[model samples]
Target: MSRKTLLRAGPLWQGGVSPYGLIEDPGAGGLALPAGFGGRVVARSGRKVAGLTWHAAPDGGACFPDGTGWIYVSNSALPLVGGASALRFRADGSIGDAYRILSGTELNRAGGATPWHTWLSCELGHRGRVFECDPYGTRAARPRLAMGRFKHEAAACDPDRQVVYLTEGERDGCFYRFRPGDWGDLTEGALEVLCASGGWEPVPSPAALLKGTRHQVRGARRFDGGDACHYTGGVCFFTTRGDGVLWAYDARTSALERVCDGVLAITSAPSGDLYVATREARVDVITPERAVAPFLRLDRPSGAELTGLAFAPGGGRLYFSARRGRTGGETFEVAGPFRGAWAR
Candidate 1:
């Protein structure tokens, strides 16, 4: 999606070496990566990076292109102190600045990046909501009440459909779709829940005044513990930890298929591989060919789960956060040739 070459859906490397050839020894940060790749702890909670303290319990994250470098925004899932923060990188990949983008939100967890470049940070409890924040930190974050109120996990914007698909984290959570009157405007939208028949029914009470949004729609399908979401190549991919299933919704056919098992946070690579941070302390890559393999493993010091997963602008660098690291929480960067690996 960043103007990089897309990995074909067919067999990769054609009797050649895989991009993830062989994992090298663990780095100083305890992350095992493939050869030609390196990892380092970029930031930690209770510590400062670029003069600003990194938020604790870093959960969901996304990367946006800046003038030459990029900005990485991560949501803090610590209750009552939850918010989202951003780190701006200079062209040389050094920290240019770090600041808060969305403050005062509670239990901010996984969210998706909008095609317009805004980050949709979702709150993670019964009273949760979606906050559209400017990744650049220039504009104040705005809460979109029209997106409905529920225990939200993540959101994925399908530019072609002009709709935003949201995942709920409840045990019996419902997959939701929001259709805005205008493409980029999220202020007013028709919130609908997905039905088992592939049809959508308007949410009787998006505010959930009478009951929970999931229950308001009589026939709305329930997803177990929906987690991270990502949209790419006409499909919307999401994960459910309750059942450990990775789901793919074909936008064109309006069909849902189970792609894999074991998931947490998910991000798509420019090469068409879906990198998923599992409930386990590792990240797996689901290639376009449907072959799944371990991409990276963390010798988690705090026995924490992997949460955030996002690729830098060119997809050469990957950024993810350990929900609870040695320093309470930590964000790590893995640099390799993931983007242009096919041509090697």
Candidate 2:
């Protein structure tokens, strides 16, 4: 069956009744957040937090629950020195530990968290690859070479389907899915590209020895600057930064639809609301009712882009980063009642 592609148009966010009240002016750390919400710097480039120095060019990030508190992993996007670091938070929201998880990677960008508690840190470039990282800093990070080598952006693992959906960062990139030889194992897999004629086709060579993975498969649908992906409720959502379009792929029917426009990175709250970071230094929310509204905004550091949106366990605080800020790369946390119901 052929898939339906929907197109939408609008500003950063459409008006609607937001669960959170009006956003306050730039407060601490130049953050304009909803009432009852406050922001603080968790880490800054070249700065030390909880004794461990934070990584530079903070990109993709995610939170993992520990015994009583949680762990937040952030990726570094520097070419040669790029790696991933983690920060452990106590139950009282205090830093307990900080350390590096993955090291010696290149241009690490936005990545997704695996259901098995691993962080899929993606490298950005023609020779980019995906590295599976242990957020707890116990096991060693491994490179999943079978996932295909290309300019990777974000990855979304569908545990039910036993497959991992990935987005490429090229101007003419292809959405891909990798089916590992076995569930919970990334040792080997078959890389398939989404075809415009419907269904998926396996790429002849994932290594791209002579041809790029996106160009290896014929009739493959090309996404403009694919970035930021999330899978939930049998739907895989991804974004294309080039055209500023958000897409939803239905796993059951293999159908694709345009959800909205103008967003970069996205993360879902415990209330099932989607929070998207915008290029204009703002974060917006799409309610379960499909209503869109502004959630938070960053005031200073004009031209800085927002990314790495993640929520800590219990949904009490949200963490994100500005890859390029006025002072430098900075990761922040916004604490509020994110698990509350939407306004009627």
Candidate 3:
């Protein structure tokens, strides 16, 4: 099947305004053919400026159809305390109306959409939590305290096996899976933290002594609020920044195993392949056999911090967001030349 590659370019909005930096690589071309990619200013939020630490981060976004011929993106605007906003974009790259999903949450990072069409926004701070927001903007947002939230990063939902996988974004975070008591309705489900043993295990405190080896526990103290998905069968993966370890939560045996380390973000491809993004502006393909290799490296300079990664619907292309230098941000679309093939 032939894949369609549609590129939309515009300037990213910061501080409720357009920074309007150079979009294309000036050295590569005359900036006339749109050498790299252009970014469109979607929406701006400046009402509560006093509460925000910085301008709209717009860190992570996912593409989803919104009844009309447009796609909606749940953007993580504020870093730690500000809420996330949902913005719709047209096929022509025009920005649409913006809606507030959840407010007063900590560090709304990159979250994945549930199979049921709800957005699971994760907090990236020490007091992180997850909230489910309706894309239609008619439902009240609530936190799933049973999920044991603590500095969450991203979440992916399987929807087929009725399991929602979650990621913790801490120095030595743990991967978690929430098996809701009822799959039909997510609001009233029993949330269980992934455990190695049959019961709860204590997570060590920050001051706990650790000399050489790492300790694996069954359960940590529940945060009464965390970010997660209500979708079923989603793969649960988490990243630990200190050692750069990625762990996959096993649903069948309730055990966490090392899947991939030295990566920043993990997203499952439509072909069941896992794509891991590193902070070094490179992405790797992790295979079923646990082999790791490079897929693509951004052509930008070294200061480009690759923050968010998401696969376009149908898995034809991969998209990543990067903040280059001090004030510029760009999203790159890599054409999938090799289908079902993992790269470096």
Candidate 4:
């Protein structure tokens, strides 16, 4: 019930065995956590709990706070038929219910929470669309049509600038920004692609920005391959899986910085630091400065890809899902004394 948070996780991941003493998970659940840290099984694919059957191929996810509990939303990346779900975490830390919050969709991947607690589920298709969803399942999913219609992958807002930065799901696709007249009102806005424009810069302007994009952030840094991105501490961090690279674009200085390589998916802690799942079947941490270190080694028998991971509001626990193999499409919550930005 009480875990000792880490003062420092020993300089990212500098070597052979983990510097921090992470005990072996006895259940053989394919995860290892630091000393004073532990995990529990919240949801598995084959189980029927809370009056709803769990779905497989769960991909991008987000966690939100509820009236007295928490809700974890995950998308199905399964081709042809992918839907979104919201799993309620009761006050006792157990699941209250799990339901399909957004239905009749395909390729639900990489969604994020708005300040208002609603979610934006991204459709990873040729004409990428973003659907606004309610974690409470109070209403039907609302499609953000004016946002853009392209191979949309990931999006995050800069609260200070009232702009939302977006990433494409292609190797040659571009990075973009959407600025609305007011904060969180994405209904009507101008969308524009980012061009390297003499060494890449973060652009803002509901007036000058393009309404959306068609993989055309002319001149901006193009990835060999990438899918998800987020905005944190004034920087937009994204990953290019093909090139195995992680990038951070500082809108303040207009500097686009490269951070990690061989990265697959990325999620940020409350501290604004990053934990990235690598193609090597391992998860690594990326500090704000771009320092990389091994966080956890995912040892799966058949070898699966870590699709998505998200931190709870306080960063005390992490929920991650993986795809492929026998135990495919499973979600796990790793609990520990996770040092949050607030801790500093």
> Per-model C-alpha lDDT, please?
0.84, 0.86, 0.50, 0.69
Which digits, one per residue and each the tens of the lDDT, describe model 3 over residues 51-93?
3322255555565655533344544546555566554544434
lDDT of 4 by residue, 76-123 (tens): 875566778878987667888889888877777776678778888888
Q: What tens digits encode model 1's per-residue C-alpha lDDT throughout 204-224?
A: 788887799998878889899
TM-score-sorted candidate list, best first: 2, 1, 4, 3
lDDT score of model 2? 0.86
> Least lDDT summed over 10 consecutive residues: which range in candidate 3?
1-10
Q: Tell me the RMSD of model 3 versus the true structure.
A: 10.7
Candidate 2 shows a clash count of: 0
**What residue pairs are clashing in model 1?**
none
Which model is ahead, 2 or 3, in terms of TM-score? 2
| Number of the top TM-score candidate | 2
For each candidate, give its TM-score against the true structure. 0.93, 0.94, 0.64, 0.85
Local lDDT at 161 for model 4: 69
Question: What stretches of model 1 exceed 4 Å from their correct place?
Answer: 2-18, 325-327, 341-344
